[model samples]
Target chain A: MVKTYVFGHKSPDSDSITSSLVMTNLEKELGNTEVQAYRLGNINKETEFILNYLDIDAPELLENIEDDANVILVDHNSPSESVENLENANILKVVDHHKLALKTSYPLFLRFEPVGCTETILCKLYEENNVEITKEMATLMLSAIISDTLLLKSPTTTEDDKKAVTKLSKIAEIDVEEYGLKMLKAGTDLSSFSIEEILALDAKQIDFKNVKSIVNQVNTASIPDVLEMKDELEEGMNKIIEKENLDLFMLLITDIVNSNSQVIALGKNADLVEKSYDIKLEDNMVLLEGVVSRKKQVVPIMTENA
Target chain B: MVKTYVFGHKSPDSDSITSSLVMTNLEKELGNTEVQAYRLGNINKETEFILNYLDIDAPELLENIEDDANVILVDHNSPSESVENLENANILKVVDHHKLALKTSYPLFLRFEPVGCTETILCKLYEENNVEITKEMATLMLSAIISDTLLLKSPTTTEDDKKAVTKLSKIAEIDVEEYGLKMLKAGTDLSSFSIEEILALDAKQIDFKNVKSIVNQVNTASIPDVLEMKDELEEGMNKIIEKENLDLFMLLITDIVNSNSQVIALGKNADLVEKSYDIKLEDNMVLLEGVVSRKKQVVPIMTENA
Candidate 1:
């Protein structure tokens, strides 16, 4: 049997990790018994919380995939966020909610929508195929939706996402507001992680208009708690910029409760962040009011400027 | 109103042209009033026959698209086969039945399947969306399936294609046997075309294992009818090899009636083809018995060796 590995982006967030699990389960239900879920990075706090809550073990780590390994990608289609040696892999299918930056030589199945979360698309696919969503799976998907949409507060939330959360919450037999707040709070626990770890928590490399850039975001309840480590964070970002030969690096210290973000910009293309937001950078940092999503807010603006 | 330019790949064939028209009509039915169909290259004799039979005018030609133009692609997704400014276009949706090789910075709708013809997928799309398929459209789609699959004789044909032909022929109110043979014979009319035009009729550039190669095919009733023009055709192929800086070029002079092909191979990578079939080239020409479809037989074999 050819073992088909399913994974998400490199920095595995809740949506990326959970959607992989959901897709692997759905593929098995569709009679592809060799499909297995894997994670490209270490499990984040929120994803670990969800797995522990449901009594489900985290998927095994996949450091790198072999050439021509059959795989399914969820939550991302950007080649930079994909596993190493992706150019040689035989991508069987792609179920992503982000931008489409993936190119393959041969045809495969692709389901890309402008939804807030990959789980929302998976919810519709399950209903369309009439596959039974178990309670554990429902909880996993519901947690992903809440995390991606920030408890339905982020502007990226769609009517489809709202609908999926309502339907999935019923199947999971959990109060959405109660469970959602707990899940979001669980993700905000970043006290133990070092500055280097925080910078790598949710970083994604984006190549836009021939510009190589990296955008990293970390959620916190108190913005000041993250800003206090600004010097250390800047050092980490500079090390990454030199090592990756990046043109720009922007780290979003997002306040989850306030729905605002304080950004640290560095590298040669740092002026692009200033031009994108029309704000002056004080010591390479600026507080942008009402900014949260990297997909909805950060990427589009930075891509336009780049 | 924003006009969405819809088109297929370069070297337009029956399926590539007809599928664009069908997709345009389906989009208009779905209430997108600004959608219009276009073609990337000149229509082949076989596609022109189908359009004339249905009394439908061929779509206008498009050389290059404006930056950020709204576009919908049919029949192909490879960047090489797409429009000139496709990298700058805002792709609204893609409905293709070929390998996926497109990359976009933002999310869009993509429907790709590994079917025999793009029209087969469109036939199912129309039925699923509950849009009425007019008789002319049915005939156009039916003609495309028969052309691509060589009246269901090619190895690329699937059960879906057979079913699509059976159902579409009914709506077209024509006997499949009678019209299919006529359509196939109509495409074999290469007497009027120059050697250069014949070589450009249905050629595709494939990047396999990073090797740049070109594959061109032309159908004929008798293999000798095409082989008679071998000197001129070889001259044309040599010109293309120098102009395009190609590594290899293979032209399949396929006999539609006998289901066999005489191949002319040239360029630095010509040895790959000789090794693939284990046949020595006699003046760079060889007879491949029972080889018809390029997508199924030639490409896979040459790509493996390359």
Candidate 2:
């Protein structure tokens, strides 16, 4: 039997893990017992809670798709080439929110719908498969829906998220607003780790021919707190830079307080960043006003300038 | 008019440029008059020759799409989220080969099937639209098909590539094999610039809590040549590391001989690299047996063992 491995984007959250788990059970119901779910990235505390509360075995952690497995990727890699690295395995399916890349190989079946969370799509599958939505699966999906949609505040939110909340609340035996608030509260633990750890969690690698470096940002609910962590963030960045001997170093500290990001770029051409952003450095930070969203707001300006 | 900017992947080749240009014309015939084509990466020699032969203006070079334009990413990004970015735009259409991402915002009006090149998909679109395929467009689409499919030797090759080649050869009036060889020759110009200049392309930032350093890599087509360039690569890495005062450093001199890569991971862990790859250090090179494809073979191992 060809075993199937399920995974989500790098640094997966509640929705990815829960949906894959629910979907794996749903797949078994559909007569595919070889599918096993895995996490492409590390799991956070809140997702851990929902999984533990329901007593679901936490999926194994995998760093890259290059590992040996027939993988089903979710969340981050758009089309699949980014995640289709295993040479000998087959990619049976994919479920994600990001745009797809040019394909590596077409799936036996693929379901990609741009919604706030993967769990919403999987919930529908769970319902379709009539795999009696267990309380644990419901809670997992519920927490996932909450974190990804940002309590339905993100621009990416859709009617499906609202629907998922309603359906999941009933199934999981919880109040929607109260659960959402609690999950968000649990997810927003900024002080649990130093600025460096927070930065690495959301870090992305930027490859330019000969030069390659990672850029990381931290989106905070409280910018004042982010400021407080600034010293640690800087210290962490400096240490990593020294350890890795990077060509350039940077961190985008978005003050949840001011709803803006203070960008600090370091390198020989660190000055080039000033030219790239069309902003003058003020007290060691590029003051980007109204830059709250890491992907929509900050990345756009960087791309436009690059 | 909402102008559509078309482009291809960075570190571009023949496929990236031509496909975008041809697609530009195809969109025009489809009555989308505001289609603008651009190159997301540098125009490689192969593409330069193809464009010069067709007497077309090469698209402007773009280093990254991380935040650039509102770029109309073709055959890049996850397919499901392809049009998510097009949320604000009145998306005229999408052409790609990568896997699809989920987008449930509404409905998709125009989408092409996944294939080897964006140009291959464009050919189908042109035929379906019952429009004229210009000589310039034909050359571009053909070159794109040829380059992306690696002259039909790659696993991704399809019958569409052969069909595109036949049609394109009649229009472009050139023997593609000879042209492809010449383009490949031009591509292997090795390096005309210093290793320092080359390393600046994709330099990244690293943070280890309190310390900071920059990391860089120099990718080459040949291993012996990379080794020949060893002095150059090393001097460059050292100068940058020292000038930047980096605490640790490593340079990989990968040999792309017979689809195998030998890495020279120098720095503090340089001593232990031999243990990671099970390679005996032979004169400053950590010889990795049967290791090829830097993106696939090397990075994952390093991230794990490092």
Candidate 3:
């Protein structure tokens, strides 16, 4: 039997891992062919939680497809993104939800909804194919969709995601509202986390003027505790900025409830706030509303200034 | 919402793409969080056929995860194999069927079963979780299972795959044997495909002497077609071997009906045959019987001499 490997991109999270398994299983039900589940990057704790909850293990993480002879790459949906691995044959299939890269193929499944999660696409397939969601898989998919869609609260959320979520909620037999709170509670356990982890919980980076900078916001309800860790975050940010020689750095505090934000800068030029957003600094602090999501808010600001 | 991108490896076929989407949707249902799906590879015509059949567009392929600021890796159940992209948090979660790569968390769900597809695991999750299989999803899952298990005829066909197929068949509203045949017919439409494509369809590389060698095989009902494609495959593989700087090349003809094979070879020692297999080499052909699998049959012979 020919081996078909199912894998996600590097640094895959719950969605990629669970999606690969789900799709692999779905295809298996269809054809009974060989599909190997693989991972590109590390599987975080949240992903593990869902996997363990679902009673499925994670796939072996492959760093690059360059080494694999025959790769059925998941997560990333482009040939270019596959690191051009398996140059032996052209890419056979691609299923993803990000903007299509500059280089792509025709007759592809190229879904681009500007939604946050690739898993939404998987949900639609499950619904359309009429595959019953196992309670565990339902839980897993539910977490992935919510995590990617930000509980359908992200600007990237679309009608499709909304529809997918609605259908998935029914099949999984989950209260979408309560499930959101549970996942958030599970995700926001930051009391004992280090500053590095806190920033990296959902971190991001930007490159401007040939200088690279990184900013991340940890989602948490315990604002005072996060604020207490602010000093450590500043210190860590300072060191990282110096070593990397970044022009600016800041951690935006986003309140999910109020959608309000407070920016904490760690750069020498604190007055350069005008470069990123339309706001003024009061005592080197910037307050903004409806700025809870880092991807929706921070990335745009960074790109605009960049 | 820190934009979380959930994706599978590149060139994801129907399995990877569908699973990622389904799992993401489940997550959203369970946690009401945000998630995105991505693929690293391009979409193939076969998968496109299935997706288009359901009136669903393919997903957007993701760019390479190289040098990605953060990696949410999955599949491979180890941080060690995570491609060194993000400087920090190298490992997030490990989800895989292969053995855990070196160091991983202890509380991981490591599934090391020698199964044909990861969808089997997903099927189990659905069963255990009591998630009802939808007709559409059951069809897709059935296709995937059939693809992985080779219509429940291949040696890799596990009892688990059979059980999943049986259960899914009921939900899919189809007869198992009939549906299996139809799905296979749909999957292996080799009429318009080239020998190069047939060779690349489910080909894998074997490395020996610090040099990589590729093995391609095609299983057909008749030997004539295999013989017809022999020259094309040889020529194509020869160029691939030279350009890729591989050590050796070989392709096998597995006549499923005859339960035999006509193994073909390339490279400097193309005429040589392994003595142990009782290969009756009439010219360059290594004739045999009950040898329908390349991985189990031809690969052993090719690597025996290496």
Candidate 4:
């Protein structure tokens, strides 16, 4: 039996979880192999809401895969964001929207589009393959598009994503104004998450020439609400910096409504953010107006500075 | 005007040089952007002979490319094999037969096959794109395949390569045995090359955990004839080990006619060859019964041992 595990990057977002399931279904519909959907971490609240709404069971949690396990990656190709021991796995296929940072010994199928979400690319694949999108799949895909594009407000949003959202919303019969806001608000609830959990919720590690750093982002309706917990977040970030021996740790608390961000930077290389944005990082805090997308705005600036 | 540079890895081989030209031709015929073929290094003797035979000009040499300069890679994908500053370039497409060891920031077209030669994959692409393969183009591509697969005798040779050879030979209108022997003989002439030049010819760097190594292979009809220069070769290898800070440096004097290899293992991890192949290294030399294909035989075993 040919078994292939399909998964996305760690710190599972809605796009990552939904795209894995969508890709597995499409692979099965093609009738080549036995593909199983998997998640690298606990599903976020927004993703949980979508899954519960569709009544689809969450994928199995995968901590580690074997060296030669046949796998298909979705949503991400960065080794930093992928599962541990990803370099050793036999990657069979990849469907992603992010920058490619993966290298394999052998060639495999890869379909990447510079869109907001992996599900947008999957939507095109589904159409090209003549696979019908079910109501539940449509709902989940639409949710992912909205989550990633921030209801088409993010810099990463593209014409392809807008097209996918419009078509998928019709199929899923969801009001864009009603369901998108509800879903985004669902993910903003930080009451249950500890400071540690919050730091790791959507964290990504990046390696610079001489420094290693972790950058985490959380979207909220009110960025000041998250800032109220800044002291606790800094404490948690410092503990993580010590544990991972990181050069820098950054937390970007983004306001979806205002399209601004409040950053809490810590660690030795925390000055990088200050230099990148030309702002004084007083008490490791800075408010940047009109900055939202991590991939478009934050990473490029930090990478240039680093 | 849109400009794209097409090239292969450093220490360029016949396949690397020829495939770049062939891919450029194919891309242009398909009516894409303006694509220019380039060589990462000077063309080898065998490639020069083939280019002269067809009266085709060798591609311009490229040392480095600007960040986001569009590039289409051939024969290789590893940053180690590609142009300097490859990580910064915007990779538009890749046509390779080697293991996938590339990561890009955005999605691009990639046509990769696990065949013995990159030209074998390019042959299919030309057909798929409905582009006419000229006579001179056919000769260069066939020369590349013969060089890489050793006239379809190397272990790395696949059915796809054999099929490509048969079809390409028809297009080029050449007697395979006569031309293949002449081409192979031309590359075996090391009379003018210094020890340093010989070591740099077709060398590949491999980074294993806790060790960095360089593997260089030279094909000859008589292994003993090449071994006569073993002392000079070892001295050169030691110099390279120090220069590159490598833990291991290996030189394979492959007897092409007999399909066997004599290895000159040097550096700190020279014992790895002994451990991997269950052989005792006398004066850091060992004769392997049949080890013509470095991709199929040497890399995997050495990687396992390392």
Candidate 5:
């Protein structure tokens, strides 16, 4: 029997990684024994921290899928965010929490909500299917909600997400405040990564009308410390902009502790960022107060202004 | 406050017409008082029978939507199938039971399942939200499910649809077999329709790889009577093919009583239909035994062969 490969988007965040594992578990509980969890990209620090804390092994990396492969997507649905040759794969199901950008030739099961995290929707799925949420599953669910919503501080946090975090934390027997802060701080450690690697983390390519740009984000305890390497980061961003022929590139150094972001704008259309947030750039950088979510705050605003 | 418009695809079917009204009711129950249901095209005979039987008004026809208008789409999501300027509208939600083909700039609520009818998913929504199904709503829901599933005999019918029909029939206070047969027969009255009207009733444009085709279906009690007008129907089909630059045009004359379809294939790539179903086209037509569903039986098979 052929196995169904379940995975998230290319850059596997905590929500993406956790949703894949949770959906695989839910599918197995529903008697689909041939389902297996995989990750399209390397696990990020936040997701790796959660996996290590729960003593769960990370899903194997999926380089590419063959034609007619049975695939289930979680957290993201856009073909650009998924694995290569995704259009040829037989997508059986998609559980996502992002703006829709998918096209399929046949009818399939899709569950999408305007929630902060994909695991929050997966939590409801478990309750709807009458499957017991195990401690490990609860922990994974709680961790993803924390990572995506910035401990319920981001603007993207919905009522469903808040309720799921409360319920799953209780099931996991963990203190929400204490564990969430530690896990978030664990991901803020950028000492081991090079400037290029930091720039690559959580980078999303977006088209704003005619202007093409890449919006990359990194969570840190101190935005000033990340800005210390602004010269080198700008060099790295310039290399990417030239290679991809992007009109603009914006790097958001998000202060997870304070729930703000210090953005460094580069490329030809960098002034659009200044126009969007109504903040003039000082040396191509500006502090965006209370702007933590790239999806909610940065992308929409820039797309509107552009 | 501006009212949000809820509607379904153009050339509205029973499922599309019923879903828009049901979704509007669901939104009102959820405290969204500014939502109104509309229809993109004229209601069919089957939906007209349902509305008249229940003493309900058909939704007003919507010519077009303005820029940034709030919209909730039911039964369909593709832009081509929806109203004009759909890309300029703020799509708030979608309740559909078809293959996914939508792209949006923001995250929104989407509920899609692989059931026979969109009403089957709406039945689940009413239960999930603790909204009581009134007798009128139940009748409308039951009517759509019956029409889409061909009285629960279509291959697209799922277990959820079967259960919804049973539960809704009790609330609707109607006999399923007796009322369903009448409603199906009411739609089969083709005496009032011209050959062009019959061909345009449920015509769906599909792209099978590079082959562009239009597959149309019309229900009837007698296929022999419909075949008598094949010469005129072929003329109309040929005109549409030339005007639209189509590769093929297939007209499925479905016998609702016998659950069989007599298909008339025409145009340049009409041989593709014979190749797909492994039947020789006698007079560019063949009997498709036990094939009543265009979505489940015809589209997928032709797509695979194309």
Candidate 6:
């Protein structure tokens, strides 16, 4: 039997990284032993914190897929968000919690739900298959839900996510409020990252109509501290815009405590940001009040306005 | 709340029509009262037989959807296979057993599995949500499974489909061999259909590497009887090919009992038929031994060769 590789979307986050691992475990429990978990990119600080706390190793980094390699995608389905040369790979299954954009030539196993995190759906899969959820797996699942839903505060959080978090937290035997805040704050510490690294932390490439753009978001307790690096961030964003020939680039610095975001918009179609939110961009930046989710609060609005 | 319409693909067959109705019932049981089922086209003979046997009415025909109509898709998801003006509609959910080609701007509920029929997955949904399946729904689901899987003999049939068939047959209080054979034979009775009607019975428009084509399949008990109308069928196919500016058109006349197909090739790239199967097209047709599934056996082979 040919081995199958499992991984998540590029610019790996807590949910993406953890879902890949959980899915791999589920597949193995279902008697598919020829599968291994991989990460599409480097793990962020929040994911690193959880892995260290649980004493779990990070999945190996995957740079490129061999031709006709069998792959199982978690957390995302679009080719744009996946690994390089994904078109050549044979996608055997997809477990995601995002909008549908993937196209395939054959029928495959796909499980998608409008929930906050991919782990929430994976938690259901574990139950449905009657597989035992170990402490490490429960911790991973709980942490991912907490990260994606921002401790059940984001608009994308659904009842399924809330239930999964409750069940997983009890099994993992962790204080949700205490541990969630520490992990989130650890990710917010950007002093060790360069301007480019910070920009690449959670950037997503999206095409709205013909306007190509990249939306990068970073969560912090104090938005003002991240905004202090406005000039350096703009230089890095412009460099990426020029290299990729993008129409727009938005950097959303979100305050996890207040649930608001300060955005820096740049590029030729930067006015689309102002048009979408009906707000003015002061010094190439604006405060989007009560906006935290890029998927719920940003992408759809930009797509409509574009 | 605005009413949401549920439907399947055009050229509605047993699985397509039955899945729409079953999904509507499942939604209603889940507390979604403002939902109704509709069929994209006229129900075929096999589905009509099942509906009449169960003393149920067929769903109303859906011609075109209004702008921004909320809809739930069943059995099929590709835009070309769905209703007109689908791009302007808001798709809330999809329950399918086909390839993933549908793209949405927002995250929604999608459940796709590699099964023989969409009803097989719908059966799991009913059990998962603890919804009771009435006798009518069970009969409809069982008939769809039998039709799509050819009484569990098709290569597309999976273990879940086999299990569903056994369970549903007991609930409906029907004999598997008796009712399945009757339904399968009812669909194969294509003598009442015209050459054009036979061609339109189950036509699917596909684009393979810019080679636009339509692949139509019709099941029959006697291949020679259908072959007697070869001249008229070829003329009608030519007219459609010219009108649609197609590169290829293939008509697969399958014998349900023998599990083989006789294909009629037409259009500019008709030689693709020979290229795909590595066989000569004698009199613009060839016998495809053991080819019963358009999805599993035909489309994938054509795609790889294209």
C-alpha lDDT of all candidate models, in order: 0.88, 0.60, 0.58, 0.87, 0.92, 0.93
Q: Which model, 4 or 5, shows the larger TM-score? A: 5
**Scored by Cα lDDT, where does model 2 land?**
0.60
lDDT of 1 by residue, A87-136 (tens): 89989998988776776656677888788899999998887678999999
Question: Per-residue CA lDDT of candidate 4, range B148-230, in tens?
Answer: 99999999899989999999999999998899989987888888889989999899998655669998999898888898898
How do the residues B19-123 of candidate 1 rate in per-residue lDDT, one tens digit apiece? 889999999999998988999888888988898898889999998988989999999888889899888899988888676677777777777767789999899
TM per prediction: 0.92, 0.48, 0.46, 0.79, 0.96, 0.99
DockQ comparison, 4 vs 5, better candidate = 5
Give the DockQ-based CAPRI class for model 5: high
Q: Which candidate is the best by TM-score?
A: 6
Residue by residue across B44-159, what tens digits does model 6's lDDT show? Answer: 88888899898899999999999999999999999999999999999999999999899999998899999999999999999888899888899999999999998899999999
Once superposed on the true structure, which residue ranges of model 5 sit more than 4 Å away at CA?
Answer: none
Give the distance in Å from residue B218's predicted Cα in candidate 6 to where it truly belongs: 0.7
Tens digit of lDDT per residue, candidate 3, span B232-305?
A: 77788788878878666666766644567677766664533455365555555776666665545555455555
Tell me the tens digit of each residue's lDDT in model 2 across A194-304: 555576665665432234455676555665656666576667777877787765566776553345677777654455457666777765567677654444554444444
Which window of 10 residues has the lowest lDDT sum in candidate 2 chain A?
Answer: A100-109
lDDT of model number 4: 0.87
lDDT value, residue B161 of candidate 2: 69
DockQ score of each predicted structure, in the order shown: 0.60, 0.06, 0.02, 0.33, 0.84, 0.90
- Give the per-residue lDDT digits (tens) of candidate 5, residues B22-113: 99999999999999999988788988899999888999999998999999999999898899999999999999989988999899988999
**lDDT at A116, model 4:** 88
- How much DockQ does model 4 earn? 0.33
State residue A95's C-alpha deviation in candidate 5, in Å: 1.0
Chain A vs native chain A, TM-score per candidate: 0.97, 0.78, 0.78, 0.97, 0.98, 0.99
Q: Which residue runs does candidate 2 get wrong by more than 4 Å?
A: A52-55, A63-68, A78-88, A102-108, A124-133, A190-196, A207-213, A242-250, A253-264, A267-278, A286-290, B1-306
